[model samples]
Target: MTTQLITPTQSAYAYPLLIKHLLNTPLIYSPDQEIVYRDCFRYDYKTLGKRIKQLASMLKAQGVKPGDTIAVMDWDSHRYLECFFAVPMMGAVLHTVNIRLTSEQLIYTINHAEDDIILVNEEFLPLLESVKDRFETVKKVIVLSDKGAIPASSIEFSGEYEALVSDAVPEYTFPDFDENTMATTFYTTGTTGLPKGVFFSHRQIVLHTYGVMAGLTAYKSQANISSADVYMPMTPMFHVHAWGMPYLMTLLGAKQVYPGRYEPETLLKLIVGEQVTYSHCVPTIMNMLITSPSIKDVDLKGWKVIIGGSALSKGLCKEALGHGINLFTGYGMSETCPILTLSNLKPHMLEWGEDEQVEIRCKTGLPIPEVQLEVVDVEGNPVAHDGQTPGEVVTRTPWLTQGYVKSGEQSEELWKDGWLHTGDIGVIDQEGYLRITDRLKDVIKTGGEWISSLELEDIISQHEAVNEVAVVGITDEKWGERPMAMVVLKEEFQGKISEKDIQEFCMTFVEKGQIPKYGVPGKIVLDAVIPKTSVGKISKKDIRGTYGENLN
Candidate 1:
């Protein structure tokens, strides 16, 4: 059968899906809607539109041409949001510099991306000063400061961010270009070696924003977001564009508050003062917010948060529920534009009690709109959807990165067998819930059996004394590998519970036939904290590197 095709009028306008169009709805519908940055700055969408033009003019005056890379090193602020649109709309690539990477990795990304201009926060001046000589392609630097003060530095300054925007012509028009033009590039440290760069087109980003919007609002779950809800982002703007929420929220014309630098007190204050109703962050940030002394003083009853970047432990889900913060899991990686699934409950599941819902909330979740996900065995065949058998997760999505920038070999491996290999071990239930068990590299292979580190971590996290926990396999002579736990206890219980106590707690689970007896950690190391990646996931890689050899 042949498919029918339709032809449009010769004079009909062929609109392209560009980032600039995202601005139009907001400017027309919510022109006066406020976009706030900490306690200092606040402005409306109309002004934001003008400022975007001003920023583009400023960059143009500084010789930023289409295809040039413009990098930003500021915290999550209105300025960063401005760049998110203005740079791409101008046909240049936006490089969101990961401020958390080590100095070497940071310099490598800046150089690797061939950034032509960098809008850097004033606080990071010393970092650039110490390594400016190493930068290979950075041609200019614009200072971003809350006080509008441009401090002295060894590197030649292009200008202060606001001053340049204020002086540049605001009437310059944004030209239309191919929707497939490269719009943004950011390095992801999800892989080994140096960071791998992921590039996305304007069309891909637009579709992704729509995909996330539909996924969040279409469901009847507690985490649904609407235009009436106040939105703030707890994730760093540099990480997958804060899971691409800025674009989604902007398109909705929702009120936005950007908390600069993520100070606990400031985050809590903004939430209460602005009545922030919707936000997203890693589990670590949620843990920090709940454990903070200021949290008790603030009211968080109606706030809705989505926890991603790592698994949402059932213990954390229960703890957050007690504080009246609505929480759920979102799953993805940098390679996937960072949003493949969200743990939004189905209509029927909403009738279940909180305890029953927590189980669903902690699963990796159902795939978001336009995402085709599957758990495949070693041979690339689909696994049973019984939720017991584990397999590697792979996906096909409109927004997945086409390839890693400039690295042919790595890109091939990433898209092997025509699917984007997630390198994650996961399972799908009969009801379509996907639960990630472990990273393929992090899974423990011990004495002819497999033990999931995530499962062990979940069990340990439920203990009353446990504040944070990470379980990794250490080399063992008899078992080939054995589980080891590095734990951090709550302040009140730091001195009360010992390592032996945690081992006994896991043994109780073993007695219930929850985990196998051998699954208990052979050694438990209580510490002040567990190591975390730049995006706040538990750093099991670092843990194993530090203790893998000596612990056994």
Candidate 2:
């Protein structure tokens, strides 16, 4: 029999799940590991820890206090990583401002967050100054520059980032507080009216870090990351903490390289120079890199990449595989603290042929531990996991965002029925792999049947002359909605391929029973490039607004 044991007095060392604790594991094991910043500078993990303290000291010297919010705008760099920890650890909220947003939307989010301090990159000085007069709560602006020069700007300079931190002490006592304290905030990039603010607490972030680490290390595949691997993020740091990889990697004591800008040449060079082994990006960014003239000579054989933000098409996967890139799909959204599933194969399935594995790799993938994922009907009933039946995907996980910042109505809709509604339609197979069919709002309906726009696009992507394609439901007086194709042909086949060619090619899939006959598009509009969202997702919402008539 076991009994409770307690000291007569407090233990004096009770631990709170603070963000600073994440640095403990790395500080102990790999204090000397390197974190590179492009090709510009490099520092050891020991220095990184010291810099984090310096950053906190600097913030505190600037009067940043508990419950205040601080905003940052910069490319993916070591400085952002420091703020990810320093601001939150000090009890101030870190608002990762999405610099890619429209100027008006950016202003709205800034006001909505009520940030007291803004740590902005030199490049965004003009952008920040343009709306500085309209900000209601901004108290100071700290400018960051890689070359150590603060540019002249209209926004009164509070100080330069490097200069202020240089004079601050390298030590500060981070106080203890409730684990549920708000740690960070960022806005979702939906094409809806305004960006909705989502916030996470210290406890939630710590648990999420553990969950992501478990998902990556527990899997036995090419994407199974370890401390030995060099990490780089192709996604923007302002976007969900670059899909939360920076924290996950640093905790594992992995070497990280931060590319200042996303120019294809720079990325390819850093990949080769730093010997980066693991990376994640949206399909559009990967597409841009793969098609770049510079990537042809690099050795991508052991490069493990997780493609997210949108569905990965057959054409893109084939190209990546041809270059020996270990490519697969991952699924998550801003509301989920970014990662929910990764497409890693089962142990027994490892021997399967490459083509067979690629099929599974391209699916939406299986959920990580602590993520209870379910596909459900409109009434909230669970759907069968029979692979053919489609339903909306919902999930329950501890790390998920509690709700939108202060919008009770939207927050209620987000947590309806005690499950986080993902608004994504998916199908789960017998082996427990989930494949997203389409967004609930993007599915096409015609002739009394539902057709998956993703399925049609994937099929069309395999066509010889196709480069990219988007399928949408266009208005039809008789059918209610009809599938229309916005096709982007390969450069070699620009005008050589016609609308009939695409429609006819789609029917071949129908003849093979791969897709329904009605799934074929009625009209195909050739385009040079398909419009995309800021995160590289197909701009279906914007496309519908422009081309879709009464196609509700």
Candidate 3:
């Protein structure tokens, strides 16, 4: 027998309740404790909160009414953190623009979201200047710059963010808002077409924060987090709101660090000097960090890291373990509040030996308590949890975006029957662990059978000479669509490894049918590094654009 619990609507829904833990908590515990800013500046929670409030007031004074969109263009910084709180708490929508996108795409997103204001970093001013005339809806430009000189430009209502916030009162009262009211709008990096928008409501974001903080999730204990744990998220703020780490850190009261423009050396220095305990980024960033010469002397033992944005390869996981880094994998997308599952060890795995447990922790873990995940076939039938059958991963959660902002293509299908359809193909074990096999679009079909490109890429990346690898399906007359491999070799091994040697290596693991008859790459184009999205995933779109015509 079960009892009915009281509903949230039965009680008064309050805005401050979302951040009640932070606002009501003691601000004096670490007055002098520092929140490092890109290894350049630092501030305590007291000072940080003051700036947040002042920024809130400044937004209010500038007529940034509730529900208005205020976009931010910057790497992770204290000012960006302030906007994280100020905009949402003030009942406005915070739009994070992906600076890595082409300038035209950036303008398209700004116009699509109807962003009324943009809080930009000094380093990104030139990009904004290039596209300012195209932003029809943007009314104001607040520059978050260290430079004192303000350039005289055609763009109106431009001023330094520091100057504007310094003059405003640091005590703006947050208004009451419906939990369902939209709080954030983060645009997706359109691999195929125009970028689509995913807007999250206040209630969704607040609940996501709690879900992440829950015992079963990645962040189990708040006490483990303090002002001392330095953070360097390789995940860009523009991508799924940096996997919601900015908000989680503020609630945990941890000192946050951001790598401005993501230099591996700069990140290594910050991590070693600041003693960064926790971080989240894609496997690409991890590859760069571990390979960087600057990190050779740094002590990474006991450092907690959550890898996402793409599948974490076993080879990369082993490299991290060798350095004594506590690394785990997470999986999510721009549409699902960015964190649907984490590879944290479950109760059953706790009894296993450390080595066995580490292996389990490397696969994408179970869903967060509130998240309901399933792997379904083309007919929408649930796949078996035997860990062999693969299906499209779908989910229903409180924090998922309602729908794409304007796209009418299968909006119903995306949230059909109340479950958000994630195009990832994956399998779940009896222990409730999820292991993503391949993206639906990236799966190679040979002789009417599916091959996991992700799995192939993982195997290829293990080659000592290979720095990066991307596998895509090319049109084939006999096999429907055959697998094609594009590789970027390490600097030292460049021009040394032949295509025949790589093909021979792949033949060891996969059967002839499982592997395409086409043994080698149709074409090999060498690059210094793989092109990546802002979130740091290998951009297959770029790869296809460069090689699609040749394949045809």
lDDT of 2 by residue, 1-552 (tens): 999987655657767898888898999999999999987779999999998899999999899999999999999899998999999999999999988787898899999999999999999877887888899999999999998777888888788888888788999888899999999999997767799999989888888889888888987865788999999999988888888888888899999999988999999899899999999999888888887888878988899999999999988899899998989999999999988998888888789987888789999998988999999998999999999998999999888999998799999999999999999999999999999999988998898888899999998998988878888898888888889889887778986989998999999999999888778888788964588887678898877777777533
Highest-TM-score candidate: 1
TM-score for candidate 3: 0.91
Clash pairs of candidate 2?
Answer: none
Clashing pairs in model 1? none
Per-prediction TM-score, please? Answer: 0.98, 0.97, 0.91
Model 2 lDDT at residue 421: 92
Best by lDDT: 1
lDDT of each: 0.92, 0.89, 0.77
lDDT of 3 by residue, 1-552 (tens): 899976677567544444433444425564454667775667787888788889998988888998899999987777777787789888889998888778988899999999999888777777888998787898888877765456665566567888888888989777665777788897787667878888988778878887876732345421134445766677877787788877776666666776667898788788887778888888888989888887778888868888888888767777788888888888888899878888877555557765686667667877876889999998888999998899999998888888999876657768876689998899999878899988888887766978788877777777777777888777776767667787778779877888776777787655645455453445444443567776678888776666565354
After TM-score superposition, the amount by which residue 245's alpha carbon in candidate 2 deviates from its true location, in angstroms, is 0.9
TM-score of 2: 0.97
- C-alpha positional error of residue 439 in candidate 1 after TM-score superposition, expressed in Å: 0.3
Q: Is candidate 1 or candidate 2 better by lDDT?
A: 1
Which residue runs does candidate 3 get wrong by more than 4 Å? 1-22, 26-32, 215-228, 347-358, 408-410, 511-529, 549-552
